[model samples]
Target chain A: MHLYDSTIPSGNAYKVQLLLSHLHIPYAITSLNILATPPETRSSDFLAINPNGRIPVFILDDGTPLIESNAIMFYLAEGTPYLPDDKLAKAQVLQWLFFEQYSHEPYVAVWKFRTYWALNGFEDLSGREIQKLKERGQAAIDVMERHLEGREWFVGTNYSIADIALFAYTSAAEQIGFSVGPNVKAWLSRVEGTKGWVKIKKDETGKCPL
Target chain B: MHLYDSTIPSGNAYKVQLLLSHLHIPYAITSLNILATPPETRSSDFLAINPNGRIPVFILDDGTPLIESNAIMFYLAEGTPYLPDDKLAKAQVLQWLFFEQYSHEPYVAVWKFRTYWALNGFEDLSGREIQKLKERGQAAIDVMERHLEGREWFVGTNYSIADIALFAYTSAAEQIGFSVGPNVKAWLSRVEGTKGWVKIKKDETGKCPL
Candidate 1:
């Protein structure tokens, strides 16, 4: 497999990298400079590979390119313990994945991106916009905290891709100024303790490619 | 099956209604008054059904509540033609489903909601915000047009749930001031022509519940 990813930290891209590590799948990467003026993702060449012009486009050995990070994780985790066999359990996994993309990522990931950019000397969002982002991001975190009250993982008893999907962004919450509840804080530690787990900054083999 | 839906038009809930119509499944609905101040979805009773406070919560015969519109469609379409059997094709279907939620629905559906509210004497968004929504919504439509250049459906040769997911909001593009390209326009007609297809405001068996 070949992955068109970003040099910057993107939780969407990292979800795929984390799952690949769990499965021990080795693949080549082409890291695009997303922070570059005009961003490499919007270039005509990159857009040809993905019309939406987003990174983490995973190319199968057969040359078919797949976009969307959660979908890619779903594709990679098939037949593995990371994706359950029970129909309802699988659907529950997907429900969390969708929730991560629609509810969690938009606020948490965007706030983290803005904070990263601001720390690096670029501030685009106003105080009000940032405040809204923080509040909404906190709401998503609270949902996770409530869901994790008695559960170890997001879905069934086992740690599944649903956990990985939410963990990719939630792991960075505190750094972006959102308080992590005790349940979520402990769950983050549990995710890190999972066998063969890799940090967002590293590749599948525990190597920091950048 | 029992569905907790909205009294108003919701593309998210309509995806389930359309799929159930195609599958000839009989289900009961508890339509919440979402347009009411404070919205019934946020009420304690409805929140008990779905912590997310969102509609289109489908409950199975054994009483397992399913959230997320696309996830519900995936569970319902498991053995049907609406979801395919091939692994790669299935992944592609999911890719579009995620894209619809993340990229398409936010802009297009929000624009529609704002327009509906403004026409009904409640103006929440400024003109500038509305313009931004229109531009972003058009960008999503443009991506769909490029993908549908020669294809009859969003994924594979059949009319899978990928088409259904995208079609839910894209069908309303022109009504909300976004232009529909030729390819997407034709594809909408094709989706409407599918067997067991129902309008967004109608339930299964082709009755307008509202």
Candidate 2:
């Protein structure tokens, strides 16, 4: 299998990398600077691979294209310890994954990316926009914190892709000046201790290694 | 099984309803007005069932709550015809569901909801916000159009949950003055023809009926 990687930091893409490393899947990476203006993701070539024009597009062993970071990771971790075999437990894992994409990433991840690339720094952001991002992003983080209050992992009892999915961005919360609750912070650390865990690398631009 | 249905129009909730009716799974709905300001979803009682406080929270026969609309549908559709057994095809269904949540619903569904619920009118929206919504929402619709080209369903050869996920909102595009490509319109027509398909009903609030 081959994964089209992004040269810039991407939590969505990172989710795939973490799972691949955990599964001991030795695959190839073709890094593209998707962050560049008119992102390479928009090119016809990338578009042909993923009409959505996004990164973390995985090419299966059969050479078929699979997009969506969570979907790709779920495929890879299906039989691994990262994905539960129990049906309802499996669905709960999915619930968090969807929450990560819809509630968490949209606010937290976008804020991290835009603020990292912001030419004029956080002060340049409109007060209202900044406040909204802070409030909403914090709300998402709060949800995770509350969920982790009496639990160690997002799912039943083990670490799953649900952890990797949210860990990608939630781990970066403090770096972006977004305050994370204590429970989330502690859970983030627990994720780091998981077997086969790999760190997300980035350069001075606060982005993925090129 | 019981589903905590929402009284107001929710494309997410509608996806579950359409599927249950199609699957002929006899279940009960406890409608709550989640669209109310400080949404009823935020109430302590609703939060007990779903920490996310969203509707379409499905309770299994054992009384376990499954949140996330797509997750609930996926759970219910398991071992059924609506969800494929093939590995890769299942991922494809999930990819589109994520696409619907991340790309499509954020813009298309939100636009339809805000515009429909806007006390004044869509005209009351800020010019820049409106423009952004139109462009992003249309881009999502365009992706679906391209995918539907020469295809009858969103995934493989069958009408899976992917079709229901996108159909809940894509079908409402025209009602909001959004233009959909011919192929997308044709596919929408095809979805309606699926066996046991049920229409999403609504009351005067542009939402599901009582």
Candidate 3:
């Protein structure tokens, strides 16, 4: 299997990488500087693979192109311990996946992007944009903190993709000025303790050099 | 099953309603005026049901609270024809679900809300906000149109939840001033022809009275 991943340590792609490592699934990564000059993800070749033109696209052994980070994580982790077998538990995983994409990622991921990689960074953003980012991103982090209260994981008793999906961004919450509570902070450490865990590394450009 | 649905004709909740009708699953609707005088969705009582305080929250017969429209649709449609049996096909279903939430809904749904439901509608938004909404929404529609080209349904040769998830908002595209392409128009018609098809309707206050 091959992953059309990003040069930047995308939390979205990091979710997939964290699972593949935990599952010990061997796959090569094609690192594209998604935010670099000409934006490789927007290239015709990449668009042919995924018309949506996004990174963290997983190409199956049969060469089928699978897009969407949470969906790709679902595909890679299906039938594994990372994806539970019980029906509702799987829905719980899906629930967190949707939350990660809709509520969490939009705020947290964008904040991280503008804060670290973009030309303006967070400093370049409007006072309104900065306020919206902090409020929304911190709200997402607060939701995680509340969900993590009296629990070690996001979903059922085990560490599932829900943990991975949430952990991907929440791990970097502090950098985005999100003051995560002890609960969310503890959950992040627990994700790090998972088997076959691999930390998100950066390239010379300070991107997730997966 | 009791569906803690929205009275505001939310496209998100409409996805679940469409699926339940297709599956012939008996469900009672508890319609809350999410956009009512006080906005029932933000009340402490409603927050107790879903901490995120969003509508389209489905409460199962066992009183388990299932949040997130796609996740609830996945749960209600499990083992049914709306959900396919193949593994890769299932991932495709998930792919479109994520796409609908992340790509399609944000632009389209928010436009729909601001257009008709919000106090100012599109006219009230700043030039930047309106521009962002239109551009983002149109870009999402363009992606869907490209995907729908030469394809009847989003997933493997069937009208799955992917169709339902996409259809929920795309059905309202025209009202929001989006010009539908021939291919997307045909695809929307095909979705309408699915089994147990039910149209999304609005009551006196332009809300989904259920």
Candidate 4:
């Protein structure tokens, strides 16, 4: 299997990488320069791999390419300890996964992107837009804090992909200026202590093989 | 199962309703006044059911309330024709589901909401914001158009939840001033022709059971 990813840190791509690490699956990575003038993700070659023109496209051993990070995680975690067998449990995991993509990442990840890129002299959002991102991103964090009040994991008693999905972005909240409540902070600590955990690597040099 | 939904024509909520109608599952709906001042979805009572305070919450026979429309659809579509049994096909369905929520609905549904509410003297987005919504929304539609070039459905050989999820918003694109390409239009007609299909009923009278 191979993962078409980016050099810049992406929580969405990292979700797959984290899960693959936990599962001890060996795969090759093809990093793309998404911050380039014409982002490599939008290039014809990459678009051929994923029409959506996004990274973290996982190719199966049979050469079938799958896009969407959460979906790829779902595919990878199937029949493993990371994914529960009970019907309701699987659905709950999916609920959090969708919530992460729709509510959490749009704000938290976008804020991180804008903030990080602005430091490099690329400003994408206006002042007002940044304020909205902060408010919305904090709201998403608050939701996670409340959900973690009496629970260790997002779905059930055991650690599941739901934790992996939310952990990717929520862990970076404090670094990105969003306040993390005690519950979420504790939960992040628990996620970090999980076996076979790997840190997201930063690739400062923007270079990729064609 | 009972569905906690809103009277307003919500593409997210409609995705669940359309699936239930297809499966011939009888479920009661508790419509909330989502357009009201302070929106009943954010009320303490509803919040207790779903902390996220979003509508289309599907309660199981065991009284477990499930949030997220796609998750509810996944739970209901299991062991049914709407959800495939093949692993890769299932992942493909989810890929489109995530794409719909992340890439498609935010723009198309938000554009539709702003345009519809503007007619009733409720303006939420500024002129510039509306333009951005238009461009983004049309870009989403163009992606769908390209995907539907020679395909009848979003995933696999038959109509799955992917089609249902995308159809909820894409069907209304023309009414909101977004042009639908020929391929997407034909695919929309195919979706409309599916068995057990139901139209999204618009409740203009803003009343709901407390």
TM-scores of the candidates are 0.93, 0.95, 0.95, 0.94
Q: What is the full ranking by lDDT, best candidate first?
A: 1, 4, 2, 3
lDDT of each residue in A98-178, candidate 2, tens digit only: 999889898998787776664455664567667878898988898888889989999988999999999999988987777
**Model 4 residue A86 lDDT score:** 94
DockQ of each: 0.84, 0.84, 0.87, 0.87
B80-122 per-residue lDDT for model 3 (tens digits): 8889978889999999899889988999899888777787567
Worst 10 residues of 4 chain B by lDDT: B201-210
Put down candidate 3 lDDT per residue, A96-178, tens digits, no spaces: 89988999899988988877778767664567767887898888888888888899888889999999899888888886577
Badly placed stretches (over 4 Å) of model 1 are A118-128, A202-210, B118-128, B202-210
Residue A197, model 2, lDDT: 90
How far out, in Å, is residue B126 in model 1? Answer: 5.0
Per-residue accuracy of model 1 over A36-96 as CA lDDT, tens digit each? 7888999998999899989889999998999999999999998999999898999999999
Kindly report which residue pairs in candidate 3 clash with one another.
A8-A208, A9-A208, B7-B208
C-alpha root-mean-square deviation, candidate 3 = 2.2
lDDT per model vs. reference: 0.87, 0.85, 0.85, 0.87
* Poorest lDDT segment (10 consecutive residues) of candidate 2 chain B: B201-210
| lDDT tens per residue, model 4, B1-210 | 899888677888999999999999999888898878889999998999988889889999889999999999999998999999998999999999999999889888887776665345325445666678888889889989988888888887899999999999999899778999999999989988999999887646533110
Consecutive 10-residue window with the lowest summed lDDT within model 3 chain B: B201-210
Candidate 1 structure quality by residue, lDDT tens digits, B1-210: 999888777899999999999999999999997767888999998888888889989999999899999999999999899999898999999999999999899899887776664345325455665667788889999999999988899988999999999989899889767999999999999999999999888433222232
**Candidate 2 CAPRI grade:** high
Q: Under CAPRI classification, how is model 3 graded?
A: high
